[model samples]
Target: MIISNIAAPLLGLVDTAIIGHLPQSIYLSGVALGAMITSFTYLLCMFLRMTTTAEIAHAFGARRSDLAQQTTTHAVVIAAVLGLAIILLRPVILQLAWAVIEPDPELQRYASQYIDIRLWAAPAALINLVVLGILLGRQQAKYAMGLVIFTNAVNVVADIILIIGLDLNVVGAAWASVLAETSTAALGLWLIRDLLPPWRQWHITPAYFKQFGAMNRDVFIRSLLLQFCMAVMTGYAARFGAVTVAANAVLMQFLMLISLGLDGIAYAIEALLGAARGQGSRHKIRLWMRLCALWSLLFACAYSVVFWGFGDGIIRLLTDLPEVIQTAKLYLPWLIIMPLLGHWSYYFDGVYIGLGLTRAMRNTMAISVLGVFVPTWLISQQWLAEEHANHGLWLALSLFLLARGVTQWFYLKRHQRRLST
Candidate 1:
C-alpha cells in the first residue's frame, strides 16, 4: 500500500521536476494551477474509489462476490457519467476557475494547454479509481500496487520522451498523462479478469443504484470540500505572482508526497477495518486502529525529520531556478511539520470509510474547510503582509488538518460504546 501510494504522488513530482526546470516559471505555475483545476473536476468522483473500497471490502469479508461485482458496475457507470459531464462542461469549469484564480495570461495559457488535453482522460482516470478500489477491497495489495506502478512508470517515460526529446512543453506533459491514464485503465480492467464476470451476468438494478448513491453521497461532498480547500491554496499562491506560484507548485508536490504516503496507511486501515466490521470483530477493528495510528505517527515523524534535514537538497533536485528555489526554501517550516499536522485527518478518513461512518467524516470536513480553513486564512490575511501571505495559507491548511482529527476523535468517542460493544 505504501509503495503504491507513494508512486501515485511521484507522478506529480515528475511533472513538477520536468516543468519546473523550463526557462520560465510560468510553465510550472500553469501546470500547477491547471492540475488544481483538473483535480477539482476529476477527483470530484473520488467517492467512486473510497466507497467502492469500503463496500467491496465489507462484501469481500462477508464472501459476497455478487455484491462486489454489482458495486463495481455501479461505480463504473457513475464514473462514466461524471467524466462525460466534465468533458462537456469543461469550458464553464475553466471560466469559474479563472474567476477565482485570475491567473495572468501567460500562466493561464500554459494552464489551458495542460487542462485542454488532460481532461479527455476524465473517464479513464475515474474508471481507474474504481479499478484500484476493487483491487484494494479484495486485499489484493500486490496487484493494486502493481497497477499504480505500471501507470506511473508509463507516465514517467512518456514525460521524458515528449518534454525532453520532442520539446512539447506542457502539452507534452498533459498528453503523457492522458496516454498513461487511458492505457492503465485498460490494463486494470484486464488484470481483474478473475473478478470480471461475463457480459450477460453484469446487471444493475434499481436497488443497487440507491445503495451505491447512498454509499457515495457523504464522501462525494467530502472530496469536493477537500479539493476546494486545495484549489484555494493554489489560487491564493498564484496571487503572489508566477515565481511564488511556481515555488508553491514545487512545494505542493512534496505536500502531495506526504499526504499520499500517509494515505497508504489510511488505505490499509480502510480495508482492514471493513473486513473486521464484516466479521463482527471489534477486537480486530480496534487492534488495526491502534496499529494504524502508531505506524502513521512514526511515518509522520520520519517525514518531518527528513524535510527538516534534506528538504533543501530535495527542493534543488526538483527545480534549479534560483528565485523559485530561494522562495520555496523560505517556507520549509510548513512542509517540515505538514505530515505531523496532517496525518491524522488522512488516517481517520480511512477509519470512517471502513466503519461506514462517512457522514461523520463529511461533517468534520465541513467544519474543517468551511469553519476552520477559510476563516483562519481570511483572518490571518488581515494581519499578514503580502510577502508572507503564503505562510498564512499554510497555517490555515495546517489548522484545518488538525481540526479534522480533533472533531473526528470526539465523534468516535461519542460512539465508542455502540461501536465497541
Candidate 2:
C-alpha cells in the first residue's frame, strides 16, 4: 500500500524533474501552475473515492452483499456523471481559476494549453477514483496498490518519452497524464468486472441515492476546502515571481512524497476501522486507532529528520536552476517542521473515513480553513514583509494542518461521549 501510494506522487516528481531541466524556468513555472489547478479540480471531486470507500467498506463488513453491489453501481454512475460535468464546465472552471491565479501572459499560455488537453480525460480520471475506493473498501490492498503502481508506471514511461525523447515539453506532460488515466480506468473496469453487478441487476434506490448524496455532500465540501487551501498557496506563490513559484513547486513535490507515503497507514486504518464499525466492535476500533497512531508518529519523526538533514541535497536533485535551489533552501526549515505538525491530521482523516464521520470531518475542515488558515495567512502577510510571503504561506499551511487535527480531536471526543451515553 505504501509503495503504491508513494508511486502516485512520483508522477509529480517526474514531471518536475523533466520540466525543471528545461532550457528556461518559465517552462517549469507554467507546468507547475497548470498541474496545481488540475490537481485541485480532480481532488474537489474526491468525494467519489472517499465516500465510496466508506459506503462499500461498511456494506462489505456487514456482509450485505446486495448493498455492496448497489453501492459500487451507484459510485460508478456518480463518477461518470460528475466527470462529464467537469468536461462540459471546464471553461467556466478555468476562467475562475485564471481570475484568482492571475498568471502573466506567458504563464497563462502554457497553463491554458496544459489544462485544455488534460480536461479531456475527466471521465476516465474520475472513474479511476471510484475504482480505487471500491478496491480498498473491500480490503483488497494488494490489488488496489497494484492498480496505482500500474497507472504511475505508465505515466512515468510516457513522461520520459514525450517530454525528453520527443521534446514535447508541457503539452507532452499533460498528454502523458491523460493517456495514463484513461488506460488505468479501462484496466480497473476489467479487473472488477466480476465484482460489479450486471446492468440488469443494478438499479438505484431512492433510499440509497439519499444516503449517497448526504455522504458525498459532506466529503465534497471538506475536499473543496482542502484543495482551496493548496490552490491558494500556489496562486499566492505565483504572485512572488516565476522563480518563487518554481521553487515552491519543487518543494511541493517533496511534500507530496511524504504525505502520500504516510497516507498508506491512514488508508489501512480506514479499511480496518470501516470494517470494525460495521461489526460494531468498539474495542477493536480503539485498538486499531492506538496502534496506528504510534506507528504514524514514528514515521513522522523519521520524515522530519530526513528533511532536516538532507534538505539541501534533495533541493539540488530537484532542480538545476541556482535561483530555484537557493530559494528552496531558504524555505527548507518549514518543510522540516511540517511533518511533525501535519502528520496527526492524516491519521485522523483515515479514522474519520473509517467511522463514516465525514460530517465531523467537514465541520473541522471548515473551521480550520475559514477560522485558522485564512486569518493566520492574512496576519502573517502583514507581519512579514512582501519578500517573506513564501514563509507566511508555509506558516498558514502548517497552522491549517494543526487546526484540522486539533478540531477533529475535539469532535472525536464529543462523538465518544455520545456513544458512551
Q: What TM-score does candidate 2 get on C-alpha atoms?
A: 0.97
* Stretches > 4 Å off in candidate 2: none
Any residue pairs clashing in model 1, and if so which? none
Q: Give the per-residue lDDT digits (tens) of candidate 1, residues 213-332.
A: 887999999999998888877888888898888888888887887877689899999999999988888899989999999999999999999999999999998999999999999988
Q: Which ten residues in a row have the lowest lDDT in candidate 2?
A: 1-10
How does candidate 1 fare on TM-score? 0.97
lDDT of 1: 0.86
lDDT for residue 395 in candidate 1, whole number 0-100: 94
Residue 125 in model 1: lDDT: 88
